[model samples]
Target: MNLISFITKHSQLPVKGVENTVALLNEDCTVPFISRYRKERTGNLDEVQIAAIVNFKAQFEALEKRKSAILKAITEQDALSAELKSKIEAAGDLTTLEDLYLPYKKKRKTKAETAIKNGLQPLAKIIFGQRNDEIDYEASKYLNDAVPNEDDALEGARHIISEWINERSDIRNLIRRQLERFAMITTKVVSTKKEEEKAQKFRDYFDWSESLSRCPSHRLLAILRAENEGFIRVKIEIDDDKALNNIENRLIKANNATTPHLQLAIQDAYKRLLYPSLSKEILRSAKEKADESAIQVFSKNLKQLLLGSPLGEKRILAIDPGFRTGCKLVCLSAQGELQHNETIYPHPPQNDSKGAIKKISSLADAYKIEAIAIGNGTASRETEQLIKRIQFKNPIEVFVVSEAGASIYSASKIAREEFPNYDVTVRGAVSIGRRLADPLAELVKIDAKSIGVGQYQHDVDQNQLKNSLDTVVESCVNTVGVNINTASIPLLSYVSGIGPKLAENIVAYRNENGAFGSRTEIKKVARLGNKAFEQGAAFLRIKNAKNPLDDSAVHPESYPIVQKMVKDQGLALSEIIGNKEVLKKIDLNKYCTESVGLPTLEDIIKELEKPGLDVREKAKVFTFNQNIRTINDLSAGQLLPGIVNNITNFGCFVDIGIKESGLIHISNLSDSFVKDVNEHVSLHQQIIVKVLEVDIPRKRIQLALHK
Candidate 1:
């Protein structure tokens, strides 16, 4: 079968769409470019569909590389039989390929390799043939003072056959499959260690075990953490007798002359060759699967966090809370322009509260601020209260934004560009305000992993987590169009085809030549290649473009079609925009072509209905209690309103006005079998819940979404 073609057929996208997009993506076309300008080229695949195809293409390429390496390694060892070569070539998984390559792989000298080198090849073959009449004679022919008696010669022959059994890829594959099915992961606490303070949470994990398939990612991560911290040892175990029986049923015969000899050989091979290797492989595979699952969970949470309520182009007062160092106050105008910057120490500006209030009020009244965005870091709540105590009849609404990566962004090159005249802390205040204005655009300036909404995010494979987060960010950026005039280089870089250099070029071109007149003008940016232009143009919207539709997310490719639709309706672009009747008459199917499909056409039509619509909703004003700083504040069955910080396969974590969020396990989701935690709750969702249990010392809070 044609592998790429086969994958395309099963994939969510059209075969030609995936194939053509992969080709372009491989040749350096940016995802945004292909998604926006190359609609006709890729059958109108959107960024999400195109990204999926690119990932699959990378996977297939990696698999092909591994296959070639396996084939070459075996052929070089002269162990490549015609049938074996064919089987190895046909194999898909790494596990199966490794199985086929086992015998050919270079290894440390073993008993079997030594015995084979001792000139007992013919005798070993004779004994394997299992001709009862010749077995004893064959054994006798090989016997010597060095070999001892018949039993000794027979034993030597068994060793060779055992090695062959171990070498058989089919046997190894079968055994691995069986172990995966029957094995139970058993975790144990190391009683040997004199326990330290931080290792206490893991103390209970030292002697815990669960089925490999059923183990939640968080649980596995916890156990792995304990092991790393030297608090426990973990192992996976299965019944060896049952495992042997399964193998014997497939590879050994009961009534042949070689039966006893084969059993001995097979048993030895299982111990010497297969079991240890397969165990390690299985554990590694499980860990990788677990990591991927967890990273995906992290990615979802991060995406939600990044796309959380935009402060909606409203002027905001930003406070990067500090006590001894004084607060960094920055005011961002509705258009994200830095209107004013200053510092006020409500806690210590020489312990002068009157002066601090006067300064804060002066900045607020000067900018006519609609709300205050306080970074939820040190002294954040105190800062919020200070702002709230002010006597404006309709006081500014205050929100506590997660400041996880705020400092990182403040110290970044992008931050330097936004605030060249201020300190890092002031830039952080600006970030907090901008984050309230548009989280996705601001968070992209910081590393996704640094956002800290994930479980064992640091412990998992770093490269894998990065790739997943990158995909999520790319998807989010494309989904929400960037303001070409207002977008920073960091936000611009994530557009489908644009990289750091191209992003800088676009910004430089804009700075040098003034604001972009239209999305098409991005072509003038230095080093902004055709591929980059195609992916990035549509997403980089110009609010006051030469064409009104350019401000809307209607791609350049769909412009002519939309223009025709507007003309046919006898309505101007503004007249029909946000009008349901006129939009209903615009046939989405009429625009469908080999390059543009129903999905892209429909999406374009919707974007036209609400031009430059902020995809994120406004987060509600949640009043958190000061009393519940930690899990110890909660009792069983106690009710509390909280924010859903994260959702994983096993459960959801709710920040119930506490330091440690409570877990709402999957079982408690609906009093029914909850297969996926995301189906019930999502990141940053406001939820009211009851605390089922709280182990203060362990810092484990079990919560239920019963309300």
Candidate 2:
């Protein structure tokens, strides 16, 4: 198959774009680098389109590899025929290739193999022909010690016939089509596990039935998870009689003495071979689709969470709130460095609210803290109230940050390396403060799945999930443009071409020397060759560089073009920077070349307009309903402000300043159909919601968009 044509048709992108994108991918260019810097060659394709080409290219290669393996295996077996080889080579999909290869695939000893060994293949063929009315005579002629009687001989022939019918691609395809159109997935609770406490969570799937094609990905994943847990028996079924009739119509061409034998063979083939094999194939296909859908959801959520608003380099006093153990407090500098650590007991056990207030005010005044970040965990509300009571020397904004993966980050090796002397509590507090200052930088340190922004994260394909999350992190990091001097190893690692080793080397070089004064100086880092620099240089920013374009998204390869533009305009490079009036007056067509087109020139102009400007908004202070502290305070029809903390296919979960986050179901998102939950809401978006119902015992809250 023509891979470029295949990708073009599938992605619905321009053929030239797909072709050029694939070529660039083969050159080992990263997605961010290609999409951002090679717009001219790629016809201005975006990151998503380039990534699709990458996926399709991989799929084509895998298919070709499989085809070669199958062909080689068949040739080694001396079963490769001209026609058979053509069919195998022409097969575009795995299903078709495997179906064609089914007849030659080696198998364990079965009744069919045993029958064929007994020399009943001839008899099977004769019976399959349906030309002889004397089947008994033929069976008698084939009788031997192994098949002592005509009845046994006929049974053996039928077994061989069943195997032949099972291997027929047309018959298998017919059954597959039936399954694809009419299959229903049903589940039943395991009788032994019916009353188990762990089984209650999946009780909705107990004795449930749904059309497989129409079943939502989340529901299917849930059912599969339940079955994996041994809490339910999942089955995929179609109208058995309808499916068998369709196969018979396609296979049975005659009615004679062989009619009954053929009917028996058909039934055996349908039950013993076709249904089991094809049903499993269909289920697996469904699972792959579900995995892709879940992974897309995860990737989207991770992107939103990573691109979330940053408070941006502010000195912060962050607290990991608790009651009996007291609140763990850490002061962070504007650069997210840990400055001070202590414990403040303002709630329960110690009940030193006065001392805590004094300490917090004094610390804020001393550290010049711009904001306070409190983890939304145990005693959070009490701590917030206590902090609000304190009259600070300066006005301080308070943010209730999500503590979903704070513990994970705190206990991570990276955290330990950052703060060797501090314990997990201090590290966790520091993470909260840094998250408020810049969410993307701090959140990247923890695993994306542990961030609690995805659905069925553990249940999906692990490798695919990791790759997708990593891509999102990489894209977000490159989009924001990392600071070379201050970015942590994890943050620097996601830059276009810099992996962990290069990131470590860059940091080491910086420590040995000093901050990178220009993009040209990055080559001095150990193991950072020209290729890595070419792909990674544009995404790494050097603030206050001698060459100002180093801090912008413009690639160094385009430096000459920018200099020419400045020279042509008869102005200095510094005068042209952020001079939109002058930039708009210059004709972009003058800089167009064979490699650099109008697209590249336009991008360079845009970068010069606002070099290294963050695409994310600044973080704002949000307060939950002060009167509502827990699930009990929530009531139907009450309007409350909430933040969208997590999103899934079904809906988005809103944190309404409570222990249990309320779910705004897809149906409740808008008056019309909500095809995508993201279309209605995004992660970390602050919105107002109307409480629909509150289940205190179950600790579930149902909400609706206030609008």
Model 2 error, position 251 (Å):
1.3
Q: Among all windows of ten consecutive residues in candidate 2, which has the lowest summed lDDT? A: 1-10
Most lDDT-accurate candidate: 2
Question: Each model's number of backbone clashes?
Answer: 13, 0
Residues forming the 10-long window of minimal summed lDDT in candidate 1: 1-10
How much is 652 displaced in model 2, in angstroms? 0.8
lDDT of 1 by residue, 272-337 (tens): 777887877787888898898899889889888877877678889888988898888889889878
User: TM-score of model 1 relative to the true fold?
Assistant: 0.90
TM-score per prediction, in order, is 0.90, 0.98
How accurate locally, in lDDT, is each candidate? 0.79, 0.91
lDDT of 2 at 701: 92
Q: Which regions of candidate 1 fall more than 4 Å away from where they truly are? A: 5-52, 132-140, 143-156, 254-261, 337-343, 348-352, 416-421, 586-601, 626-638
